[model samples]
Target: MNVSSPLNNEFAISRRRKAAMIVQMMISDGGNLSLSQLPESLQELLTDELGAIRLVDRDTVLGVAEEFIAELGSLGLSAPGSRDGAIAALSDHLSPTVAARLREQMESVRFGDHWHIVIDLPNSRIVDIMNAESVEICAVALSKLPTSKAAAVLAQTPGERARRITYAMSLTADISPDAVHRIGQSLAKEYGRPVSSAFDKAPAQRLGAILNSAVTQTREEVLGGLGEDDPEFANDLRKAIFTFKDIPARVKPTDIPNCIRTVDPAQLSSAIASALAADEPVISAAEFILSNVSQRMAGQIREEAEELGTIKKADAEAAMSSVTSAIRDLVESGTITLRDPEADTDE
Candidate 1:
């Protein structure tokens, strides 16, 4: 990566370049690493020298270098500059306060070569959309940006403005999947085919390209079949799938309690037992937990969870909700941990 960017203030480029140089030097040593391995004091001393050369605090420099090495290890290869740009781009996308601090410590920031502008103004006419307004009005008003400031700005516009842009986008010929596929086929036929390696990877966006396929059941069946075999493997495949436009209202309170009664008490007890083992002790861990929560609630959940072995439909859903919420709060507050490692393994 070129640490010297056209827009960076002075000293940033130099600092980043030094960091890169230090990383290069470390990798050049040709040493291997393992989980059990520990660096000697000599190696720690070497880090100080490298840190000075990189213009970073010793610990900061070593920590970053270690992370870099781990990443390289994952890929089982290294390519200088390929990762450099990504680092810089991520820095470029940080909030102003964070970016300023980072800029003070380094020379260059990374930025993407291109970006997209999605708009969704509902009432705006298809033909009346303006790109400048989309950029200025919508993009300029958002908070907590995850990417470049400019890109974040475009994401925060009012819903009406977004709808207008989306409406305009809808008028385009891109609506016809048939038209686009034919063109892709034509290009592929002409160019032959791309040579791909085992390392060939698809980005989330590329994986989302299946949204245009026309057959609803066909898509579901294909994806569902894969999910039946390995659910995690197909998780990303449904990233952009469409669903019903209307959402139903919530179930009644009585219905919720009935749902709670459906949980298996044995499963629930095992889960809670595990959670309690890892959990920090309150003045009286079990007592305190049961005190704030109703005994009847706990009883119902316990009964339902226990019935898992004998019956499939126990209707302990309401009780389960109470248990889940209580457990979540305790765990989040650091009051408890799952003592039973096997509890989560059951599901």
Candidate 2:
């Protein structure tokens, strides 16, 4: 992505305009770019230049030119780094009034501890602020938000709550299409069954509608978890579930199995673990889960006995005995990790 040659496409035009605005504002600030505020690559390049501490105006200008070149390349702009030509072009494009307004905004701007913007604006405004790279102030201000306000922010967030806020909403949902598919893979691992991709079974129009309606935050969280565990299945699932909000609360039990059939048992277990782990002791709630199994499945319960070593052996045996059928079903389905000392030793 050469920054010097601005891609003439719509995306490029918009990005170039934004980039020019940022560059103009930065130069106006006595070229004093805070170390934390610079892009990662630019920071590294500047660090190298600052190391020699070269002070000559010509030398300094050359260094700045180098950075400009780097930025142009990275930004994929057609503008050259040579001061006389590209800089003049940039000057013409950025009006003094626009630059002054931006500078004024920058002056009043206060970055919090995280160095993000400190404003509570609308979501669209938040998105704009993110583009301005002024989100750090917001992160600092976020801690002051009341619990209810914080919750509302979180609900509106699309990815990791803290990250989204910190990154000024620039941080997209860590959840990707690949991650969603992986969740199904994980479920299959635990269940030893073929997990289904919802996209595969449903009509494209219906699936698209479901995804469009899904909760963004939920979809991202689920996709992230799935991606980390099951990349392939996550990709598959990405096609099946367009949005997390697609699933409704009033799902029929019969429909539940169809969804379950698409999920891998290990994935299910992981989801269960995650759900229980979040301020809830899932292990303590194991009994409720166990009650749903049958006698044949109960025989497989002994495999998990060893994994329960964290608990007393006697207690594990007692718990397994108490919910033998359910535990066995979990074991057979691969929902629980069976402690195999041999496997542990090899690892």
Candidate 3:
């Protein structure tokens, strides 16, 4: 297979340099080379080419290549057979003053590097780190973040866990910069870059979405707890958690059709029928669903509902639940966007 253009030049240069180094190493060491002593990448490449060649012959060649690559890396050099190595070679060739200037410029792009570190850390690992620390410490660290990043972290956490952390924050007063700085230093070490004060915020709808997927009991308990502690904040969480009933008010006319398209036709019909048949019918929801579809399709759905005559409340609820789940999935995947009334009207 042909290597991609981006890999070709660097791979060739690195491979040549490694091969030369391996030869020198082997000659110096009594012309002996061991395949097992070679780096795995070089070994794999050489092994692939050894299909027709004798194993012993190919092993010696690979052994040398691995030693060369390792030696180059040890000398603060990039592996000659990789893209990074090529970049390192170019940097090394530049004048010292020019290189120092470039390094300074690169350091200013720390945000990108910091982002990669955060992104590379798995959600579970982040949670583990938070859980391991004292609640006060965790809260202090979280509060130091800008709202968006804090929200993103909270969204990933289980509702109950997030509530505990939020509660801890409420109970605490001032957060010491020294404490935050120490934590920052540890995290910076892991990231291999200086810690910088920058973070990306998740959208409110996305946070709502994470809670939507949470267990109903956990969501309720957490919200109830938050309500007891801070009623207004709890109310905000309530507004964020959208349900099927919110479809009429939150979903835009343009997105309604696309949202319905994602739901099963049978489920949509059942959900609409059940809503219409209720003692206090969800007229708005029924209208929202019907208005979004073509007249012919709406008529057919109505006919189907009429033929069903009566649906048990349980069945209706189950059907509606399915349709709601489909809508949530669509929204989360960005197939559709739902407007948040409160967020839009907020000053």
Candidate 1 lDDT over 49-90, as tens digits, reads 455452345555555656666676889644333334344456
1 against 3, candidate with superior lDDT? 3
Candidate that would win on lDDT: 3
Instruction: List runs of model 1 lying over 4 Å from the truth.
Output: 1-97, 100-315, 339-347
- Cα RMSD of all models vs. native, in order, equals 23.6, 24.9, 18.1
For model 2, how does the per-residue alpha-carbon lDDT over 255-303 read when each residue is reduced to its tens digit? 3333334344433343333323332333433323333344443223323
Query: Which candidate leads the pack in TM-score?
Result: 3
What ranking emerges by lDDT with the best candidate at the front? 3, 2, 1
| C-alpha TM-score for every candidate | 0.18, 0.16, 0.40
* Sort by TM-score, top down from the best: 3, 1, 2
Better of 2 and 3 by lDDT: 3
Residues 271-293 of candidate 3: C-alpha lDDT, one tens digit per residue = 88887786343657887788888
Clashes of each: 47, 47, 3
| Residue 22 of model 2, lDDT score | 45
Regions more than 4 Å wrong, model 3: 1-226, 279-281, 345-347
